[model samples]
Target chain A: MLVRGVTGMARVVPETRDEILAAAARRFAVSGYRGTSLQDIAGEVGCSKAAVLYHFANKDAILTELMAPAIGMLQALDERIAAHSGAAAQRVAGEGFVDLAVRFRREIALLRGEFPELLQQPAFAHIQRISERLIEALAGHPERPAARIAALVVLAGISEACGEFADIPDEELRPALLALVRRALEPVD
Target chain B: MLVRGVTGMARVVPETRDEILAAAARRFAVSGYRGTSLQDIAGEVGCSKAAVLYHFANKDAILTELMAPAIGMLQALDERIAAHSGAAAQRVAGEGFVDLAVRFRREIALLRGEFPELLQQPAFAHIQRISERLIEALAGHPERPAARIAALVVLAGISEACGEFADIPDEELRPALLALVRRALEPVD
Candidate 1:
């Protein structure tokens, strides 16, 4: 019985970490990284700040953890698009980018509002590289002005949609965002 | 000749204020509002921090003065659009928004990257109201979810385009951005 109880407690540990992360994400999204403090997150999570620290080294660690999954997904999308070229690459990258944007809406909100400082951090250095690579893939690796501008518009559209339409359900927002992105990328006459 | 020299000296005062604002805008864009210091702005302008203070009351004052013209332009656009309806309003607001986005590219860059904290200050309170009114005008005052989403996407696209395509000359970028905004607002079907 004691062994079973120990196993049960082990399962709860990871759940607690996730709960802490969720609380941190919400706080950071609403108040911003510089504006939010550990005490605020702890209050939201209903735990002591020290207890929050026990699960995460610090607030930056919490931010890093919150974004790690999205970063990994972006990196994977980058790899997936690397195998394709031309319009095929653009289509692949676009679909994957939309998926990631909708799935990680909160993180994208934090990023859109606070990217300069966040991206400048050494821990997020890879995110900048991955984003540039993703942009290149979406632009079909073209250095042309039109293609570059189109990629940027589509990207900005996706990020802003996620933040601005918070009241809309993701199921509704996903197709709307993808359609808008497609329109933005349509050939200019 | 003495009077002319005095007039020239008077002109220099406003010029110095302009120089200080330009330097602060650049620093805020690169490092964000929280990360930048008054001393840094002074350094960039090759003046004492005290000289910077002489022109503006504080860092927040510098930010407010930098954004005041853009906010005023938005208010004027809002009033102009108030008299129009449906597609006409969207068109007018879109053109004005694009022009402001391009003309105030540096300010838009700072707003896009650091808006949440910057907008919360009391001095910038009017900016938030003006932005909402502008968005309403852009959306043709529709409370519908799709229209609201489209307006946001277009606004975000324009703002992001101005920041991302800094190398593209404004003359070339203006038409490209306006075209993209129009395309993004087209019916999804």
Candidate 2:
């Protein structure tokens, strides 16, 4: 009976860990860092608080895992956008924005939600650096504030629209959105 | 001694609340929602956990309050954006985008930091709704997906630049950013 209990307890650990992460994502997504607790996460997983600690050190670790996929996806999207260079750069950038907008709406929303704290994290600093590099590569100058601002505006607006404007279908908004971005990238008079 | 303690305690409530919020903002801004704690916050404010809770019912309430000001500012910016109409709409929208870009940079960075959950709160939802309304009012139609998309692209690009490209000063960025936004709103082939 002791051996069986040990085996069963071992099986419970991984499942409990997954459960804790899932629960933590929901709570953190809604309540943020300060609002959640190890106790609350343990309760959701139907495990002891110590069980949660065994799998994950703390809530921060849980949040880190949850957002890892999102960060990866964003970087991938950046790569895809960068792939659209040369004469087709403009069109490719537009399509990339549309693709990202349509596919990653939920992730974008989560990012927007968690963004304030995310910005301060060392993990996110690399993403910012990557973004700046991408902007420089695309605009041909790290110091082109106008181009940088224009790119940011387009990206943020798309994120905002995709996450919030569910009533406006993607197809309807995609073309106009691209046109706007292209215009924004144009040299100032 | 009891009377003196009671008076001291009473005097501490409002100040403690403000202190907690301020500290929470700093922590949340760095560590994010899942990374911070009421205990950490209390330590910052030089108070007990119970005292922190005495001011805020929970972490959610604290985050909600921190985000409240950002939401209000966005709303006010939207109102200001809406106040300009007609042929001047494009130019006014450009200017508004620049102003909001400057204002929202820190808060947006903070949003990206710890209190990401605030994005789901009604406060953010309200900002989204108001922004949509402002877009509609400026474009004079919800069906103008093209124009709406254009506006979104321009505004979003500018906002993104402000946060990710802080190395660039506002004086150089602001006017250039305005021009980029104006260009985005212009007719495209």
Candidate 3:
């Protein structure tokens, strides 16, 4: 019985960490990272501040881990997008980007200005290359300044809209989002 | 000579106040409200902390004043958008919204997650109504959830992109942005 209980307790440890991440994400989304407090997250998780700190060294540690998956997925996207060029690349990126944004709506929301000096941070430095490549792949016309702006809007807009209208059922929201993206990336007149 | 010196000092007061507001906006946009401090603003303005406080009570006060013009413009956009219905309304709002966003790009950047509990603030409460109406006007097909999502993406996307690509000249950026908005609002296939 003692050994069985130890195993169950071990399982609960990971579960508790997941719960803390969820709580932190919600608070950061709704209150902004500045507005959220360690105690606030602990309170939501039904844990002590000390316990929360034990799982994650600090708020920044929690943020780094919480956002790792999104950043990793962006890397995966960069590779897939690398296979194609011009229109083919844009098509793959646009569809993949939309799906990624929807799948990680909350994570994307956290990206907008969550770290304005994002490139300066050692943890977030690689984002510059991945995002630049992604934008390059998605841009409608590489030479024109306006074309680049449109791509920025489409990608940034989709990420933000995911969180803004998160409650909208995925089946209903995905197509509309994709349709808008297609229009933005259509050949310029 | 005493009166002339006094007059010069009075003019300098407003200039100092303006300086403070400008410094705060840059700091807030970069480091975020939570990351920035009164001392940081003062340091930027080449003024003392006491001087910054004298001009504004605290960080929130400065935020309110600096964002007042942006909010006021949003209110104005609401009136212009109210004049039309359906596509016409979307056109007016889309163009007007993009223009407003560009004109106040930094302020719009500050809006994203700058205040997650924005509606709760008494000063910013009216934004709830204005933004809802603006999104309603910009949405492609009112009957579908997707259209609403599109509108949200367009408006939010423009605001964020304005800050992200602030370097692109207005003449080059404007038409391209408007073109994207028009495509997003086009009749469904």
Candidate 4:
């Protein structure tokens, strides 16, 4: 939150909650989710454990909040894809997925590392359902084994690309990634 | 080992060494490398812990041996790609990778689930070197960021597809994978 400084000039106020989440994300990424603790997050944020706890109930709460935006975007993409059918649906799903994956690379890295079990948790279960819908939309013809493989490839390929080309600027990588997904989801003869 | 039975018939003898390795892989896959123990391996194989230790010195030895085949094949792919230049190299690399990924879905699952830290060890170091080589081979023109992204996507995408479409038979998934990769590596305007 912003507030006036001592001299009456506008200044940015510290948002301890956002800072805690940022620290937690960094800690969780460097060390596995299981390896990181509230203390570690607090230490990174230059705060006490009590301060960290003050912002969030626990580690899961912090992670869930950090992930909330990504999950929301994914759900939005699923909803968008639902309106289209066949090839149009596949294109929409591909574009939306690439955008989602690019914007949430850290979340993808977090999901890929140390947290498959988390997806089974009630909080993350809905993500699995959204993913299934996105996959179905991307597949075009869901019954064909070939189409199924293509859709799966696009879903996973983009996330992989995000990590692999982490050094590349998103603006440069985005088109390449989008093109790859478009091709990967294309119907095979 | 085959031996003569009491009735003078050739009987296939139980190879305790192979049995121990098989049990260790299964245990490691399901419970993770760190999560499993020699006692678990021995119990699964219906052998004593000493017997398990006698065959393999430790858990790392078992993992090293289990991953030996995959690392070997990946090196072979890298070597095959070295002989060709440009698109031919990309084609050979893609086909070789698809074959390798299809044949080692369980190994990929094992890598994905646990033991990523295991990759940095001396025993698994060669896999990393080979993977970089394979990535270069897959990318026809490494200087272009787009080409780089495409190659990285296929490398990780195939592994992801292997797990995502695990239920699909190799004969069915393999050709579809190959086609999708072929398209992914194609030049984009």
Q: In DockQ terms, which candidate is top?
A: 3
Better of 1 and 2 by DockQ: 1
Query: Residue A12 of model 3: what lDDT?
Result: 40
Among the numbered candidates, top TM-score falls to 3
> Would you list the C-alpha lDDT of every candidate in the order shown?
0.75, 0.60, 0.77, 0.76
Ordered from best to worst DockQ, the candidate numbers read: 3, 1, 4, 2
Tell me how each candidate scores on DockQ against the true complex.
0.56, 0.41, 0.68, 0.48
- Per residue, candidate 2 scores C-alpha lDDT tens digits across A3-37 of 33455455644455677778876665445445678
TM-score of 1: 0.85
The C-alpha stretches of model 2 lying farther than 4 A from their native spots are A1-133, A164-173, A186-189, B1-21, B31-35, B54-84, B88-94, B113-129, B138-141, B154-169, B186-189
**lDDT tens readout by residue for model 2, B33-142:** 55688899988888788988888878788877776666676677677666766555545545664676665555554455322344456546676566566565435334
Cα lDDT tens digits for candidate 3, B91-171: 889889878877888787665555446556888888888888988888746676878877888877787666775687677
What would you estimate as the lDDT of candidate 3? 0.77
- TM-score for each candidate, following the candidate numbering: 0.85, 0.59, 0.87, 0.83
Q: What TM-score results for chain B when candidate 4 is compared with the true chain B?
A: 0.82
Q: In candidate 1, residue B184 scores what lDDT?
A: 68
Model 3 collision count: 0
- lDDT (Cα, 0-100) at B76 in candidate 3: 90
